[model samples]
Target: MPEEVIFESESDRSREEIAAYLRTVADNLESGEGITLKSDGDSLSLDPPTHSTFEVKAEREGPEGGPKELSVEFELEWPEDGETESESGELEIE
Candidate 1:
């Protein structure tokens, strides 16, 4: 499926700063509030359903003889109808 680009912002940040941002998002999710992401003059508000698809991915990309770049991504996906099936699993982060 084709995707539309929304408000986007990315830059290098300290680990402490990144943790702070993630904490804010976690708080909002726990409170069942829409998340508003703003960067410069662009902004987007997303109201995820109570049950949504949560995904976590980790990847490494690099040339055969070069250094590798590692990245971890977290995402939440839900349909416009706000219907989703809940899944149970064990995830340990550390």
Candidate 2:
């Protein structure tokens, strides 16, 4: 499926800064409120269903004989209609 870019931001930040950003998102999710992302002139708001799909990924991208770039990504996805069904499972993050 084709995707449209919304508010996008990429920058080098300290671990504490990154954690603070994630905490903001977590707090919003706990409150069952929509998320509003704003960066400079770009802004977007998304209301995810309660049972959206949550995904975590780790990746390494590089050439065969070059330095490798490592990344970890967290994603939440759901249909546009705001209906979702998900199974519960144990997740441990540390």
Candidate 3:
């Protein structure tokens, strides 16, 4: 089964702004040196310097219902010589 990765941050900005920011981040991650993305449909696999692979799923939820939330889900596989680690960053609306 695939794992769910969720990124939750409270932002007073509009959804469009948040989505744009995320797109930028994703694009940067995809094009950054030593990082690559192999994707199909709703899934993405990432390979980084540690020789690990990560499967990612990202989406947004908001005003159409209640408070806004940016959700990202993924499962990581570490390299034979490395251990898997999880990290996150928040963007504040100003």
Question: What TM-score, over all chains together, does every model reach?
Answer: 0.91, 0.91, 0.30
Better-scoring candidate (lDDT), 1 or 3: 1
- lDDT on C-alpha atoms for all candidate structures: 0.90, 0.88, 0.55
Worst 10 residues of 3 by lDDT: 33-42
Error of 1 at 91 (Å): 1.4
lDDT of 1 by residue, 1-94 (tens): 9999776799999999999999988999999998999888888899988888888999999999999999999988899876589988788889
Clashing pairs in 1: none
Model 1 weakest 10-residue run by lDDT: 80-89
TM-score-wise, the better of 2 and 3 is 2
lDDT for each residue of candidate 3 in 44-82, tens digit (9 for 90 to 100): 434454334556667897898688889876544565465
For candidate 3, the per-residue lDDT at 5 reads 57
Off by over 4 Å in 2: none
- Against the true structure, candidate 3 reaches a TM-score of 0.30
- Clashes in each model (backbone N, CA, C under 3 Å)? 0, 0, 3
Q: Show pairs that collide, candidate 2.
A: none
**Candidate 1: RMSD over Cα atoms?**
1.2
